[model samples]
Target chain A: MNRITLEQANAVIAGAFAKAREMALKPLGVAVLDAGGHLIAWQRQDGASTGRLQLAVGKASGALFLGISSRKIGDMAGERPTFLASLAPIAPGGVVPAAGGVIVVDANGHAIGAVGISGDLSDKDEACTLAGIAAAGLTAQA
Target chain B: MNRITLEQANAVIAGAFAKAREMALKPLGVAVLDAGGHLIAWQRQDGASTGRLQLAVGKASGALFLGISSRKIGDMAGERPTFLASLAPIAPGGVVPAAGGVIVVDANGHAIGAVGISGDLSDKDEACTLAGIAAAGLTAQA
Candidate 1:
């Protein structure tokens, strides 16, 4: 199994921040997690909320838990409110059930890691996450 | 119910890691908990992620919480997701509805302790847990 190295994790964070700056998005918190749902790296921009890291981790870890992007989880949440609500408690980092969480996949389409961003509109956060993955020369699971 | 001694707990961890090395499995985090759901011993192999210890403990403690293996909880989660999710917050250390947790039993069939492993596939982790128990001359609850 391919593991996301710390260097790649840091690169993902830098890339996400760069994208956030380009879009003038709110100061963001970003988290990178390995496939086991363990945090590999995290960063919170100045002025971001104190809970931003938690939210970021929740998004990323939740994506790993369900094997889907947080955007999809958001859609699922909309369709099955009760089911999504139940997942938050059981999930290690608590499920945010929102966009901004994206999975990074290897050549085999197996998830290697995930990236999550918070502190802006969910769509904007997701855009940064994608940009970050691209910056790291990794593929985002569609 | 008999209590698991510290010495036995250490043996369990050593034995589990031995089996893990033999099988060339990924780095692992193992936790042993007494019947009261309190930690007796814990070890996280080099290269394992930071949150691994928490996950290891969650699996064992969760088993004690429900009086069954975490594998059974995983199956229950599949059948009744809401029911399993509801138990997480109330349970100490949280509940990880996954395999890798096994209850240790005494000759009288009384619960003695539990072993939890993480940092690999659920089945592989559970296999190590069982091996650890056996190495300590304990039986896994059927």
Candidate 2:
């Protein structure tokens, strides 16, 4: 299984920041997680909220846990709010049912890692995450 | 029940690390937990991953919960994945169905505490944990 190196994790953070700057999004928090949902890297920009890191981790780890993007989780939450609520308490990092979380996949579509961004609009946060993964020359699960 | 003192907890960490170094293993994270599974002490060697601490705690706490080493929990997980996964949410620290968690016991075989190690193969991690417990003059649950 492909693992995200520290260097790649850093690069993903840098690329996310670049996209956030290009879009003039609010200060953001970014997190990269390994296939096992362990943190590989994390960063919170100036002015980002104190819980930004947790939020970002929740997004990324949740995506990895369910093998789906957090956006899809959001939809599921909408359809089954109780189910999502039940999961939040159980997930160690957390399960934030929102957008901005994307799984990084390998050539065979196996999840190698994940990236999550927060602080801006959810869609905008997701855009930066996508940009970051692309910048790292990695593929995001479709 | 006798509690593992701070000094002994630290010694466990030191001994585990010494064994790790002697074996040329990767950097590790270790956690010593009291009988109630509260952390008495923890340390992460340089180069260990960010979530190593949590993983270590999960192992130790899981051992305390089930009254067995995490290796046994791992075997249980293999036999009943859903059962283990269901427990992960309710177990506060966590129930990482893996090795590297060993319960420290008294002469009468009553649990006093647990030691957990991460950042290497499960068996290797368990080996260091055992060595640490021995160095601290503690008996592992038989």
Candidate 3:
């Protein structure tokens, strides 16, 4: 299966940061994960703290692994606290319900990867991740 | 003006893993950082989970940025959640005020960096980190 390669991930990060700058949002840490939920590429802003990057990777990994957006995961996680708690220990790179993560899809409607962004509000983080997907010639899951 | 060099950080990571192997401890994630709290080097043993890497980096980065060991900083963070919370939005690297990170001191007693070990209990993590520092010909800050 065609996967989101490192090259595409880099482009997405570039696009995400560009979008962040355009929107005048805070510097961000963004992560792109392949369909297998492994990181394809990641970048942390010079000023953004380290936690943002870790969380970004986790959020992206979770979105792709579960084939769901972060907001949806949050809702489900909230419904099952025990499951969520157990889940966190296993998914070092997955943060089920964090904001700023979205699944990447191809034009043909295939799941490709997930993009996670941090260091901004949830909506802004989502916007940046969406921009990244769009930049990679992929579409963000609506 | 003493600060951790990338080489020193890499050495700490390598030494920590070597010690873990020698002791037959669990696979480990090791992180080392400069005084400025940036990633100088990091590594994870093959069998170690991703969470280990994240937590190690978090603890090390937190200690360096806060100018205290994780043992001390964790308490501070717990008590001053708002201060730590405000810092969260600023850096791309994650910082945790948890134990397992140790400040590295050179022969002259100047802090050169910090070593953090994960994939074990907090005490074990600290022990591994100290062992790694010894391997690197350094001392842990008291």
Candidate 4:
């Protein structure tokens, strides 16, 4: 898989914010992480909810740790809240099992990194995050 | 150096955030960890200021490394910007080298974990963190 560089991470944030501004949505916070889930770049739009950053990291890290998009966690949670809750201890930090974060796959479809967004509705956050992945020319879905 | 458990870490955060809310402060972000500086758990209040969680992690982790308090760094930085800047990268989490966090310690004063709070002024952030540490029955330098 091609390494996701800081250049790409920065570009994703720039493009996403531009789109968010174009829409005049409330402030947004975005985060980009390496495949290992370490912070690569993050930004909080002026007046954006601060937790947006953590949400971004959590959702992105959750996807990366599980090697799947966060959206799938909800599907598997039918009667397994206890098992799902175990993930937080294993992963450290927090994990949100939903699709607000999208994996950034290399051209070969190998996982490389992820992008996450928060500060809007959950769906809006997911939309902005996908917009970022698309702007980076990466497939956001599994 | 005992490893910090996620449960212990979350306990600190839950307590701190509850107190912060009780005091009518703005929403907050809190992170806890152990001696190795690994993250245990983190939470960002819904309306917290942007970047509060990351800042809190950085502040708390930074204080842990120095065996002092983040307040000391903040005060010293006012007169020693270059020194603090040089120290920022020592932690990969973008430590601000300022006040607002404290290291969690063991009875023998061994560094264990840390908690950082953001979403208010630096002083208030520090106050909240102190409140959290106090809630944990651990001591902190104001």
In every candidate, what fraction of the native interface contacts is reproduced?
A: 0.08, 0.02, 0.02, 0.00
Q: Order candidates by TM-score, high to low.
A: 1, 2, 3, 4
Residue lDDT tens for model 4, A2-115: 766655776787778777877667877777776767665566654454366667788888888877766676556556788788887788646786657778887777878888
Off by over 4 Å in 1: A1-17, A21-54, A60-116, A119-142
| lDDT tens digits by residue: candidate 1, A1-142 | 3889999999999999999999999899999998888889998988999989888988888887666788998997886564455455546786788899998888877778889999999999999999999998889998
Model 3: residues >4 Å from true position, as ranges?
B1-142
lDDT values for all models: 0.84, 0.86, 0.73, 0.70
Report lDDT (Cα) of residue B36, candidate 2: 91
Per-residue CA lDDT of candidate 3, range A19-115, in tens?
A: 9999998768888888777877878876454356656766677677677887677666656656555554466464636568898877776787888
If ranked by lDDT, best first, what sequence of candidates would result? 2, 1, 3, 4
Best-fitting candidate, measured by TM-score? Answer: 1
Interface RMSD of 4: 13.2
Chain A TM-score of each candidate structure, as shown: 0.97, 0.97, 0.88, 0.89
DockQ of each: 0.09, 0.04, 0.05, 0.04
The regions of model 4 sitting more than 4 angstroms off are B1-142
